[model samples]
Target: MVDTMALLLPFGRASRTTSPSAQHPAAGLPADDEVLLDAPDDRLGPALVAAGQGSHRAAADLLAATRALGRWDHRDRYVLRLAAFARSRPEWVQTWYAAAPDDPDVLLLRAQLAVDHAWGSPARAELLRGVSPLITAAARADDRDPVPWRLALDHARGSRAGHTYFGELWEAAVRRAPLHYGCHVAALRYLASSWHGSHRECLDFADRAAQDAPADSLVQALPARAALAYLNDGCGPGVPPERLHAA
Candidate 1:
């Protein structure tokens, strides 16, 4: 509602390495405590931006201050911030989408947020219907770069065929061991749902992670979850992915 589009460039310009704890006043809060405790070289810039746009006044100001830096150095600040706001603040999404309905990135961000925040709310597919093409175009524009696996995961939830469709990607991504290594949960869910539904693969991932995962551990507790899923699905006193990988 506040003409955040023009601010996109500034968002892009700010360094992603800033300390959100220092930038966000609520960094010390429980949920944000992680952001405050860890002063990583790269902060969750996108999440911070969204927090700012949503209600985190400190996040907003930090985003604004990031603008003072030159544009040439800007990253995906607006995109990240818009995404963050859409997640915690759906009202912001409705408002921004109304003003710039055709903005693909905005629509995609909303789609991702819808699913992430869907637990207590409505099903998120409809939100995707209106913006599907926009998201497709943005993906094309970015040369099929991954927007957010949540978008793919949304489709994966719709049908058995959908599971098969994304299975290969999930497998390949796991092998690549990406940046947000933690997000593998989205992919793991899809993989576990596929026809083959090999719990071993996820187990392998967890095991490998145990061996090579960062000190901050992405899916540390994941092995147990995978084991439970295996048992629930009647996999026979199944071996947890972590243990299987471990052994």
Candidate 2:
């Protein structure tokens, strides 16, 4: 886990001695013109454009490369962006699936799209349950990939599965990639939702996870997330300022 205090000590000391504008320019707020919302990276830009033109080859190739290299974080992000694109213009995804129905990348994207679609419906639990097979197939498609397991964790949560079932999914997720941020987040959300009003339990789980993860792992951010959730919940006991700062 990251030493949060160690990481923040320098900044904490600096805050007392320096003004905000005196900090490095790179650390300062960017100009309004500099901000670009939902901008795709260079590689993703081309794929998104091609998809807009009703082509899925570039997107497929991009996801395949990410998966082949075991870049799970990039794969997760790409799958989400691609799935969002499919929601608006689905022909490309359909064409890709028809061309290669067994492609793991497409399978994952399809599962994500299905879940996203189900989330907005009134019968979310029923719809989510119906999408279980898609998530299962995606998980089965790649034993070493943790993204599908993340989706499974989310599916289990939306479907209101029991603690034992959620735990089984959580185990499968961490077994694939213990430090994967998305899987950890999915687990955290499940804990927060399934065990409503159990703020202490959620914080403890987040703290333990952060302690076990590497300093540079995104899991290091879990405690801060837990703190945010607790604060937003309004039903929990008050968290001390020091503990919140440490998080």
Candidate 3:
């Protein structure tokens, strides 16, 4: 597994009452992305269970996950929070991973989580059926090429074999575009599969996208390139082919 840089989340949300399931007042509540976004790791909110100090195992686990997410998305603080929660209670990984917004870590994360959860083909199918419309509507409305491309990449990586299966649509999704999301990730995957793209070629793709692609998309595409290098073919580091977030 690629060791993604730990993403430091803002903090855990506070409410007087904790859930019985969570074992603390902040238990079962969504994580605080805003807090993580507001400051660096040393400055993360105190509301989070002090390092090694949660009443419930879940709290500690969640704190760990958010801390893990500190370096990733500035926008999906909620997601970082969820990541912490999943680390605490791994069973929740699938549900929350699927919920991750279209961003750098989420797409690959959902897939890894789905695989970890053994979501199976049927589950993959169910998810694809649901997201297809959203894609269709988005494509019709948004002129931006990367949006749907991101969605397609999400579908391919995140599908379940049985429970969440979406069949060959994953492959088709990539082929249908105006080279949306560009082909960097796919290229990386192709290269990883058989060393298709030259290292310079992969870097060039990332360079073009970084300059022209939406700021948000650059995050997703970049990590995907990392996955291609590592997971797709077991090539390199946890870092994105291009490190956009840490910059």
Candidate 4:
């Protein structure tokens, strides 16, 4: 949901490279943990520090600001980081929930955490189904946000949802933000799931989405991600070497 799964290096791995300046130039150096996706924001640094000290107020305020500004991109990244943090140190998030159960931002965070937790379960589909209400609550909380729809798309895939239902969700997601990277990637994954072993169709979908998206869009990377998936999976006639090279 954050980015392609292949792109998620271990948390501290990127910081080990010596060329931090080349990787991410900063007016001031950010802490190792603060470095994310090779681009660290000034706001997330202090927000993370606040979270580390067992406070959710800063995290809440940061998300609220992003939401108030309709900064969906910033909201997506913050949700991923906050959910990751909450998974390990849950007390702060639990406190936040206790204090403001109806808060839209809090609901979004909780929904992400819930789905993430469900993903590891043996009864994944059943668990995912149970969490539908959380996803719905988050979606209803803010109609302008596509991140919840991204979450819903992931949930639909996990729950083995029918194509019509999945397509409906996809429509709603893209309508909110036509080129949202998270939603596009989610749709790609759904396509891959729905048409198992049809690598060509999946790759075509990825390529079209990437081409239609902006040059800087993460959707541009979807084709490469599709190629990787085909290579990793040996169930079908693997994508040709030339295709992989092209990707």
Candidate 5:
């Protein structure tokens, strides 16, 4: 078998040799007052403001536009932001659902919200299992969208689903968007959870994914993400210092 670690070594060396300024010219720690955590973009800013004022039209239109344009990445980001907002203030989403019970955007938001809610419960696995229908509804709403499949991958992990089921979800997600970073991350997390003591497997998977992804694709960061997860796990066999650096 080809050595996955060998494949990742060059990337690791490049990362170490490259100056931080060359990689990210503007990279720096902002002042506490200047930092804006998870600030919405110009398009989303107005939608969120309107939602705060008891309006879901802007949010709906925004999501619809993303879908129409096949902007799955933007759609995924916006859905998460909207879902987070809804968790604290659900009136608008409830109103949206009542108005358009079958709207794809509404269904997507509902599924995300339900998963977020269930994720924090003590009975997390049980609650997550019950969320399958909502996820299915969202997935069915748009056969072309991969965000729902990404959500499903996460759902499967949280619900303690078997490898076969998770593999099926992975196939569906990649079929929609082969290089989708979100789906890749979801799959990575599932691997980490399922093979808790097998950090090498996770790293190998990450290396393979990064190898296949384009230079600018976010999936290129999968190896780094996997390394971080392994470090955080604390229970895995010690990964070599060079390998960690390369990842």
Candidate 6:
């Protein structure tokens, strides 16, 4: 078997509980409004600005365009930014969700938001447990999209799920996008966590994934991420100098 477990990788809604500023809650957002997973695309910048101003149209349109174009990688990054925007400015997203309850973009954003919210809570595993259905619904919304499966892997890791379950998620992720960097990174984190201090196993998984993935694929840098992780934690044997050079 190809060790289906070798690959895997890994947002929330806005709420009205508190506002940084009643007039412009998102004022604290970056001056340039740079989003997480910053891609070079110019399209998303306008969408984020519009969302901050309480209009979901640009955000919705951008996500819709990404989905229509089958730009899964861009779609994934867009979802994270949109979800983060919602966290600070929930009203627009709530409106969007209410208007298009079943739109794949809407569903995916909602799932991302839920997971993001849950992950930050004091009760992480418990909060993540409740977000399971959202992730499932998002995954089912577009079976060909691996983004939801990526979220599922993150959820599984947050919930500290068993290997068998994560393996199933890993299979689903790679089946859709065999070398998705997000999923591969999630799997690496899981290995790092579950086998805590087992830097060799984590490096092994990362090296194999990086080797199998295309040169242009972000997955190719996964081994470097693993090396950095080991270096950061200063755990176990040092990553072989050869491996660092190869990465």
Best by lDDT: 5
Runs in model 1 deviating more than 4 A are 1-89, 100-105, 113-147, 162-164, 171-177, 193-201, 209-212, 217-221, 228-237, 240-247
For model 2, which pairs clash?
A: 1-213
lDDT of 6 by residue, 21-113 (tens): 334336657533333333335887777767767788998899888777777777887787678768867898899889989888889999999
Q: Estimate each model's TM-score.
A: 0.47, 0.81, 0.31, 0.80, 0.82, 0.84
What CA RMSD would you report for each candidate?
Answer: 12.1, 10.6, 13.2, 7.7, 9.8, 4.9
Ranking by TM-score: 6, 5, 2, 4, 1, 3
Question: Global CA lDDT of candidate 5, please?
Answer: 0.77
Task: Please give the ranking of all candidate structures by lDDT, highest first, separated by commas.
Answer: 5, 6, 2, 4, 1, 3
lDDT of 4 at 100: 95
Worst 10 residues of 4 by lDDT: 8-17
Tens-digit lDDT track of model 5 for 1-247: 2131221101111001122133323557543332224556788877877876789999999999999998877788788888877776689999999999999999999999999899899999889988999999999999999999989988977887777677777878878888777787777776783443267777888888888878988778888998988888887577888879999
Better of 1 and 5 by TM-score: 5
TM-score computed on alpha carbons, candidate 1: 0.47
**Residue 234 in model 3: lDDT:** 50
Question: lDDT for each of the candidates?
Answer: 0.43, 0.75, 0.37, 0.75, 0.77, 0.76
How much does candidate 5 score in TM-score? 0.82
Ten-residue region with minimum lDDT total, candidate 1: 1-10
Give the Å shift of residue 13 in candidate 6: 18
Compose the digit string of candidate 4's lDDT tens values, residues 1-55: 2222211111121111122235544668864444444334688766666766789
lDDT per residue as tens, model 3, 1-247: 1111110012234112233254333566553431223332332334233321432334334334543553223223333343343344444434333553442334433433333233245566565656655455433433333334444444444442221232233334334442233333433333232333343344444444445546655434554354344444454324453443322
**Is 1 or 2 the stronger prediction by TM-score?**
2
